[model samples]
Target: MQRWERRLSDAAHALTNCGETYFEPDLFRRNVNQFLTIIRTVTFLIAKDKANIPDYEKWLSSAIGKYWSGDEVMLWAKESRNYIEKEGDLELFSSLSVALVYSYFTENDASIEIGRSELLSGGIKKLMRLAEAELPHGVSAAAAVKIERRWVANTLPNYELLQSMIYVYSRYRQACADLAEYLGIILSTTIPTAESIGEGEVHQRRVSYVKFSDKASYSKLTHRVEIDRTITPPIWLKDVDRTRPNFEVYAEMAERTFLHFGNHLAMVFVFSENGTILQHLAFTPFDQVDKFIFWRDLAERILYLRAESLIFVSESWVRKDPGLLTPIAQAEILGEMLHVHEIKRTGEVSHKAWDIERVGDQVSLAINDNDSLEASGFPNYLVPIREAFTRIHKR
Candidate 1:
């Protein structure tokens, strides 16, 4: 264990200076990749095998002799003895303590020895205290750093506990990175254009759509007599107030419009767009509308939904709009509102206008009628959407 600790400390120092020492981007990337891979592998191994073991007493003694050569090892041993006495289970408590220590070492190798001592000295109990700290507005990154700092400060004292802590910290870091990447992809992409709609000013419009099926549960007579036939409405139309006009209203409108019209399911798509579809959103409907809306609420809270420009699509709509819809439109609206797109005719939509020359059966709306508008000059938003569709769909 002591040899491993020394190796880890040496590796950390090497990694920290790799870019400066090597002066190579590829080497830097490779080193970081290797470090991350090793961290992950060690974490998995400890979690799966050694997490329940007692402190490595023999290993610690050998490490102290080989490395410490001072009173530091004696103090650590005394603290470990006290911890074992209080916990009543040497194996479990020591293992957990050692895990916490390893986490600190991996993150901050310079303070590895001090970090080990902190873990043994009841510093880790401060996790709850730090967790209770108030976070400032719009300072999530800072807050996260603070929390990690406090956690590391509290856990760094115990050398034996380092492995387990490393495992947990690595998992958390990976999860956060994954989430950030997903959000980046969504926010950085261009907004999708709707078919047959004229380009209009970009507004944060809350939009949604619902599907009605012939196999709907509600009776036709009830739908026709009680509800306005023109307004293909949901079964629970009375619950929504479209006058206030917000995301909640849009969601309710979809449910109320589709509930009683023999529709088995309802898929909703919403985005900021102007044209006949946006204008006609008021009259859509469904059958069997439940007031306690779960899926819609969940969808609204997703990262993509909160993005500056996001499109929501229903599965039923995707089937109808297949081969003509752009990727943004498909991503936002399909599956949630409708199923995935099924490709049809090849080269029905041209990529030339978008600065893309690739030709294939990519699904995109025909811009033939709008060529005159293009000649007259369309908005810049359309250009990116067209280019993205061409680049993305050419597989």
Candidate 2:
């Protein structure tokens, strides 16, 4: 590897570390723009040489061309590179024209006028293919930098994790919104605690309560007194969790509501805070959640659910029953705390915020220097995430 190619490899390494920062796009973009400057140098250094292969030609046409070229895989790097320099993205290219672009760039089609002002998809693909085809020839320009295929080939393990997290996060936001609205209409109030309820009035109350684990038992509780002239039955509340002491408080309130209101009121609904207990509410039949459940370590469940909601509605793919996610949508986020991590070049993340702080949705990252995660949030998203670990994590 020559000095320049080696530099390019280092830059790509930095680019791969962008995974830890993916949760914060602006930071990722900032870091990418900086590292690309180093990598783009390979493009220029090779541009000056006229030999078996230039650095740009050699690097682009490497064995790992496909992974490096895919838009979804490297959108951040490519778009950031283009936008940083040109102040815009390279426009989508026509697939049909890929061959033409290839022929023009690598053949006799220079007669065709291709504008430098715009980048076409076909052109990019053609470039990648040309680079891939040229793999047989090394940079005859005397290893400007001793670079190898390894620099850009390997997939960042955590990169996939970030993608999955973002996938779930987006879904959770959408699903939670719809579920919140549903809860607003269905729930009489958000008060998890009331002033007080007495044993004598408990039977008189027109409301009934039951634990989630004991949902079947709710029907047995009958109103012992007809305190109201109308003498209606009570409303029923399905507290999301009965294991917690707080569950009793909610149950008593439901009983109080029933003692007052009677009949046509036994609607069993769970609060959003009990997200974990509401696992029964996870509705997606085909989803990443199940994969995590069966395959991954149990401790990572919180990481999955919090970063990507356990009951995520999953972006624009709307469900006919957002009600399926009611357990997560109702709770309000009270506050948040941010923690920064240092993602080493080896793809290992270490604690310690290299000066990362939440400036907006992103942090102040200099060179993918910090992998910051702002963890603390409202119990609605947290409850289920926490509960999942307790339920599934190996003891």
Models 1 onward score TM values of 0.16, 0.21
For residues 223-328, write the lDDT of model 2, one tens digit per residue.
2232255754333544434565433443344334433343112121122323322121222222222222222222233333322123211111112332322322
- lDDT by residue for model 1 over 313-332, one digit each (tens)? 22233223323222222334
Which lDDT values do the candidates have, in the order given? 0.27, 0.30
Q: Which stretches of candidate 1 lie over 4 Å from their true place?
A: 1-239, 243-245, 262-395
lDDT of 1 at 316: 35
Give candidate 2's error at residue 175 in angstroms.
41
Clashes per candidate (backbone, < 3 Å)? 58, 31
Candidate 1 yields a Cα-based lDDT of 0.27
